[model samples]
Target: MEYITLNNGIKMPIVGTGTNTYGKENKDYNGALTNEIPELVTALELGYRSIDAAISYRNEELVGGILAESSVPREELFITTKIPAREEYVSSKESTRAAIDNSLKNFQTDYLDLLLIHAPIEDKEQLKNTWKVFEEYYEAGKLKAIGVSNFRKNHLDELKEFAKVKPAVNQIQINLKEKNEDLLALLQDEGITPVAWGPMKTEAHQQELLDEIGKAYDKSGAQVLLKYQIQRGVVVIPKSHNRANQAANLDLFDFELTAADVEKIENL
Candidate 1:
């Protein structure tokens, strides 16, 4: 797998697995939790090291248990989990610290690879307090890096007023349908890596075009879409339950898209 160096000099896998719906009944995001996550096991077996999880998903312990029990050592894994912006999780500094501590206990790890505020908090004081707690953990070495997700320019500007550590990444939707061109440029200019969440969401026509492009490289449209994001320095977390598709997602290192190919897709 390829890696992107964050602003803090940590290498994050260019490709990772999104676990928003994993271990849930019928693979539904709101489905009841299941005891086991065979898909996560399959992903790890397929060489996926980056596991993107969030507290809002309500399955951290399950996901964490699988990872703790996996054959892959903790050092080789890049586990990322987010703390929600809700009152229960970020109402105060003490609440925020407790939430993070519980997350660490659930993961059975001394330190997390990356921690992020799940979304932008509207209250400036709450936001500052939550970020301060994150900074505290980061300084103590419990969090390798700290960042935010789903933050826009205004939110980032608010954070800049007192932030000492620049966000390492801003995880956002960056599929073909939602190009997020302006925000992408802003993130690039600010030296923050952009991690695409829905990297495989594309229109049928777009997929057809990507498939046509992939034919030259013996890859699928999904692969082509993921390749397009990573080629431009954007990290992608594209998840699939099918074993074949899971294996295919990691088969991206073998080919490179031409300038013409990139232009065609970019214009699409």
Candidate 2:
């Protein structure tokens, strides 16, 4: 896997596993929130050093549980977690500190590789307050780098006007179906790399487009979809409790999706 250097000089994996499920952490490890059987272990063993998560998922403890049990050294792993919205985080600024402290405690770590402000598109001041803690954390050497999630250009603009430290990344919904070239270009110009959550969009609205491209590559629709995003320099985090799909995502490094094949799948 390739790595993207954040503006702060932290090296982050260009690809990783996303853990987002809405359920109690006490369920079966595979039940979005329940199943922890072997998927987390599989991802680490597969050379995916980065793990993206958020508090809203209610799986941070499980994710942390898995990491603690793994042989992967904490230094070698790039673990990223987010502060949920204000109410959950409590108060934007103060909550970020408490949330991060809890994350470290739950994960059984002293510091985090990265931290992000989860979606707060409506409250601009609260967002800035949340970011202030991120800045403080970085300054304190508790977090290596900081960024945002599900943010649009306008939201970014609002951040820039108040932020002293520019975000290192913007995790968003980007895929073959929703190719926001305008936003991508804007982010590139600002030096913030775009990381995609649902990059293939096979679960969203790109199934038909993925189907067409799948035939050309002799690959599954999901494969073609992921390949297209990679070609555009978007970092993809495709999650699956299925070990086969997790392994399949790592195999993408070898194949080359032709330019014509990519154009054919554009925004369909």
Write the residue-wise lDDT of candidate 1 on 143-227 in tens digits.
9999999999999999999998899999999999999999999999999999999989999899999999999999998899899
Residue pairs with colliding backbones in model 2 are 27-34, 28-34, 28-35, 29-34, 29-35, 29-36, 30-35, 31-35
Prediction 2 TM-score vs. true: 0.87
Query: Judged by TM-score, which candidate is best?
Result: 1
Report, for all candidates in order, the number of backbone clashes.
Answer: 0, 8
- Give the per-residue lDDT of model 2 (tens digit) for 1-268: 8777888888887778887742334334345455454677778888878888887777888888888889999998898898876565736577667889999987888888888878854676777778888888889898888898888888899988989999998888886556777888888899997889877554445687676667766677787777777677777888877778888787776778877776667636
TM-score of each: 0.99, 0.87
Q: What is the lDDT of residue 111 in candidate 2?
A: 84
| Candidate lDDT values, in order | 0.95, 0.78
